[model samples]
Target: MLPNRSLSRKLKIQSLCSNHKQQSSLCASFSASFSSSSRCRGYDDTIPNLKIGKHTRVIFQGFTGKQATANAKESLEWGTNIVGGVKPGATGEHLGLPVLPSVRSAMEQLKPDATGIYVAAHQATAAIEEAIEAEVPLIVAVAEHLPLHDMMRIHSILSTQSKSRLVGANAPGIISAIGKCRIGFQPLPTFSPGHIGIVAKSGTLSYETVGSLTRAGLGQSLCIGMGGDVIAGTNFVDALKVFETDEDTEAIIIVGELGGTAEEEAAEWITEYKRRTKNPKPIAAVIGGFQAAPGRVMGHAGAWTGLGEGTSESKYRALENAGVTMVDHPAKFGSVMKDILAKSGSNFKKMEQSLAQQRRSFHSSSSPLRPQASRSTPLNTRQQRSLHLSVEQNATILKNYNINTSPEPDQLPKSTHFVGITVARSARSPCIIAAPTANPHQLPHRVRRYPFDYRSGPSQSAIKSALQHLQLDSAPVSSKAAIVKLINSLWTMYKEKEAITATVSLALSSENDDLIIYDSDLLFDDAAFKSCKRQQDIHSLRNLTLLAPTDLEAEAAGIMYIPLETPASLKKDGKEPRNLIGTLVNGAGLAMNTNDVLTLRLLKNPQSAYPPTTSANFLDTGGKATASTISTSFKLLLSDPRVSVVFVNIFGGLTLCDMIAEGIILAFKEVGVDKPVVVRLRGTNEEAGRRVLEQAKLPIRAFDEFEEAVREVGRLASGVEAKTGVTEEGDLDEVLV
Candidate 1:
C-alpha cells in the first residue's frame, strides 16, 4: 500500500485463519539488531549442561485453564517440575500443582532454575515481569497475539538485563522427554524417549516430524515447536544449542520455511558451531511454502523480512548448502535424519525397528491424525511451486504462476462432458479412473486411502455408465472441445483442483469422522470452499474412478478397495524395505511434453521479473504433442534422487500432450528415487496423463491432475528434510543463476 515501491511498508498482524480463507502476507513488526560478525549459533552448543543453574521448575500461570490445564497435567505426567500455579484470589489453595499467591513466594520456597510462562497473550507482559522479578533463568511464553511493540519491549528487557531465556509468545513449548521433564503440550503418546532433537515453526509440522522420527524407530531427546508466528521467542540456533548439550540428543532436525532469515542465521551459526564443538550432531531440514512469491509473507507474526532468506525455497536450499540431507516428504524426514546419524556413526536398525513399530501403529482408528477432522485444503501457491521447481535449493524462487492458490480454482461447467475410461479388470483396481477427454475442466481427481477410516469400495457399473451416459467414456472424443478450451483459458487446472480439495476438505468434516490433522481445533468444512481447495491441489482431471455418481441410468460397478501398503514391502527377516514411496505435494509436474530444457542459468542470470530460463518452461509446455514424451520426462526426472520431486503444471496449453499415463510409470521405474511425484496434467491432453498411469503395474500414486497436487505437495513436504550435517556457504545464490 505504500506509494513509493522501494519504500517498504511495515506489515501489520492479521488474525490467524479460524477457517480456510486466502492466506495473507507473513510480515509484521519487530525490533532486531544483528551483529554481522556475531556467532550466536555456537553459543547454544557451548552452554555446558553442568554450567547452567539447577532446580528447574515450571509455573503454568493459567494452570487451571483449558489448554493450560491439559498441557500442565501432561507436563506433570512427564515429570515436569510444575511447582505451583497463581490465581489472584485463590492464593493458598491447590488443584493438581501446588498453589502460590505469587512468584515471589514460589521463588523464596522453590528456588527453581528455569520457568515456563503459560498465560494468555494479554497477560504475557505481567507473567514475564513476574518471571523476571523472581529471576527465572529460562522462560518459554506459550501464547499467541502479544502485540509486536509489547514483544519488542519484552524481548529488549529480557535480553538486556535478565538471565531468563524467552522461548516463545505463541510456541508449543519444548520437551526433554527422556530427561523426565517437558514444558509444553506435546502429545505424550507420539513422543517416545530417545536421542533426536527438533526445532520447528508450525505445530503440525513438528508433530509430523516427531511421528516420522518415531516411525523410523527413533525417539526424541527434545521435540520443540517454536510456533508459526513471526515473532517467536526462540530461534533455530537457540534450539540447536540445547541439542548440543543433551547427551541423549545425538542429532537435530531444523525445520524452516521461506520468509525470514532464521535459516540463514542458523547456517552462519553452523560454521561457528562446527569450529567450537568437538562432537557435532548431524542435522536435517524440511521447509514449506516454497511456492510463495518474493515479498509475499506466509506464517509467523514476528517473521518479517529485509531481503533474502525469508522464502521457503531459499531457506531449505540454504540448509542443504549448509550440508543437510533432503528428507523429501514430511512423513519421511526422520529417515533422512536416521541415515545421516548412521553415517555420522549410530545404530541405524535400532532406529528403523523402532520406526517399524510406530508405522505399524499408524492410523490405529484410535489415533488422532485421521481424516475425520482431517481438512481438505486446496493446493496452495507455495505447494504448487514445490511441485514444479526442477532444482529448488531456494523454494521461494519457484514459478509462482504455476501454483493454484484459490478456493474457487474449481469451476466445472453446469453441464459438461468428460472423456473417461471403464476399467474391467486389473491387479490393483476393478473400478474405473475417468478423466476429461480434453482436460477442459482443468481439475484433478484424488482418492485418499489412509491406514484407518478408509473408504469402502463404491459400485463400478454405476461409475462406468455415468461416463458412457454422457457419451464421454471413450478417450479423445471432444464434442465441446472449443467451449472447454475457452473455459480453461479463464481458469487454471491447478486452481480448479484447489477449489475441489478445499471444498471436500471442508465439507467432509463430518462429526463422525475422527480425522484429526492437528490436535488443536482448526478444521475447515464448506462445500464451496472444498471445491476451491480441491481445484488448487489438482491441475485438470477427476478421479472418475472413485466418484461413482449414482445416476439411475448408470450400471452397477464393483471396486476392490486398494490397500494402503507401505512401499518396498519389508520382510520378516527385514532385508527388503518398502517400495512405492508416494507423497502429496503442491501439484506441478516435471519437464513438460513441450519444453525439453529449463536451465536456471546460475552463472549468467537475468535481472528481469520474469527470468528467461523459467519463462521458457511456461512457453514450451503451453504448446504441443506426443505419447512417449510424458513417460520420458518422468524417467529423466526420476533418475536423480536429488531430483526426487516430479511436478505436472497443467495449463490449457502445451503440456496437454495426448497420453501421460505411461509417463507416470516410466518415471517410477526409471527414476527409481521412489520419492514423491506430484501430477497436475490438465488442459488439452489430460486424459493421456490418466490413461498411462492407470495402465502400469507399478503402484504409483495417481490423483486428479490439478491444483490438488500443489496443496498436497505442501502437506507432503511440510515435515521432511530436517537440517543435517554441516552447511557450505554461497550455494543459495544459485537460484537466480
Candidate 2:
C-alpha cells in the first residue's frame, strides 16, 4: 500500500516536471532512460530540495574590499570552488581570482553557480538585483540594516523574476563542515561532519554550539546562519524542510535568539509536517538572551524585544508545545540532541528502511536514473529588448553609481523596442514628461517640453495665456485640476494612438504633493532616468509622477534615495572649529542611544564651554561589520576634514569585534591618523577587539566603559589632550590618572 502511494506521488511530480520547460529536456531524457519504478527513486534524491553543495562554484561580489579579499583567500584555501570576484572599476585585476565589474559579466566569464555578497547596506539592493538578473542559484549577503523597502524590492525579484535562494542580508552564510564547503565567514575549527543539522540567526552562538557538538562527538551535516536582520532572506522553516529531506542530516538543532518569531513559525511548519507524514525527525533548540532586558537590543539587529511576540518565553512555549526538545542554553544543545536521537532509534531505523526501499525499487527496475548538468540558454534578442531598457541607458545608470560603464553607446548593441514621448500642447498650456532617449548611443538629442512659454513670468500667467489662445480663458477648472486632466488625457492618447507597451507619463502639479526619491532598489538601466534618476533631488520633482504599467517594477529600478539628516560639521568664521563627532556603531538602536546620551549629557553639564548644540552623524555598521568595512569607514572619516574626533561603538554578536579591530587597524595604516579617535568594543570577543587596538600603538584611545568613551570625545572636542595608560596585557580599563 505504501509503495503504491509513493509511486502515485512520484508520477505526479514527473507530470509537474513536464511543465518545467527549463528542466524538460533533462526530464524527458530521464524518462527515456529510467523505468517507471526507477523514475520514482530518481525523484526521491531531489526531494531534499537543497541547492548548494561543496562542488558549487561561487563568485564574490565586492571582491576588492578588505573582508572579501581576506575571506575569499580562506575559502580558496579550504578548497571552495571560487571562480572569481566582482569589483566595478577593478575589472581584469586579479586578487587571487578574476575580478569583474558586475555579476552579469562574471556570469559570462566564470558561469559561477552562486554569489557571496560583501557590500554595505546602501549598495546591497543593487548587488542583489544584479545577482538575480544574472540568475545565480544562490546569494549570501553578509551585511545588515537593509531598509525594509529595499528588502521588499529584493524579495519581489527573487519571487517573480528568478529562482535563486537568498541566504542573508545580515547573515553569516551556510557551512557544510562535513562536506568541507562554506559560503560565509564561519569558525572552521569548531565544525565537524556528522548527522546533526544546525540553523541559527546568531553567528557567534552557532560557533559556540558547533564547538559543543564537535566536543560531544556529534558532527554537523550543515550549519546555517539565517541572518539577524528583520527581513532575512531565508528562515527556520526553509532550513527545516531541507534538513528533513537531507540524507546526511539525521537530526536538527535550532539556536534561536530572544527577538523574532522565526522559531514559532518553524514550530508550526514542523507540527503540520509531522501530523501529515508521521516521519518525525529528532529536533533540539536553544533560545538565547532570555535574561536580556526588554526594549534593549542584543548584538543582532533582529534581537530586540519591542512587542511580546518575539520574547524567549513565547518561543519556548511554542516549540515545547510543538513537541521539540528545548535546551536552556546552547552549551546543552549537543547533549539534548544526542538523548533525543538515542531514544528515537526505532524512528530513525524506520526512515532509513523507507529511503532504502525507494532506492531499491528503482535499482530492481530494468532502467537507470542519472543526474544531468544544467545549461544556460540566452534569451532571444526581441524577448530581451522587450524588458524596457536599452544597453545605453543601463550604462548611463551604472555610471551614475560610480560603477564601471559599458563601452561607448555606439559600440553597444541596439534594441528594437522603442517608445515615443510627446508633450500635449494646447493654446492655453503645454506639459513636459521627461524620459530617457530611445538610444543614447545613436541619438544624443533629449526630448523636453514645458507647459508655458519660457518668457512667461509665472505658471498662472502661462496657463491664462494658453487658455486665452484656446478660447477657454473663462474655464471653471483650476490650473492644478486642468493639468491633471491633461496628463490623464495624454496617457490615454499615447496608449491608443501609438500602441506603446511601456511609457513614462508625468503629471506636474505641486498642490499637496510630497517629493519622494527611491534610489537603491528599483532604479536600473533605462528605467532609472524615466523615474527620478535624472533629477538631482526628489524635492524638485515632487509634482511629477512616473507612469508605468507596474509601479512596483519602477520602484525596483535603482532610483535615487536620500536618507534623513545625520551628523555634520559646520564652520564659524574660521575661528575655533567645533567638534564634528563621527560615530560608527553596529546597530541602529545603539547609534540612536549613543546620540541621545551624548546630547543629554552635553546639555546638563554646566561647566561645558561649547553649547549643547553639538552635532553627530552615526555611521551604522549594520549587524555584521567585517574588518574591511571597518577600515573603509575609518578612512572615510579621516578624509573628511570636518571631523575633529571619531567615536566607534561596537556591540559584536555574529560580527566579531576582533574583526572590527582589524579593520580599524587597516584604516590606521592606509591613512596615518592625525585626529583623535575613541573606541568602545562590547559583546562577543570584546577583549580580543580591544587587544588588537592596543597592540596597533596608533593614536586610538580604547575604552571598556561606555561613559568614559563618550567623555573622551567631549574632552577631545574641547581641545583637551587627555591621555591614559594601558596595562602590559593590553587591558584598556586599567588606564587611569
Score each candidate by Cα lDDT.
0.41, 0.53
In candidate 1, what are the lDDT values of residues 338-414, reduced to their tens digit? 66787788876544444444452221111111101011122222222111222221111112323111131243333
User: Which structure among the candidates has the greatest lDDT?
Assistant: 2
- Model 2: CA > 4 A from native: 1-50, 296-299, 305-310, 346-737
Residue 179 lDDT (model 2)? 66
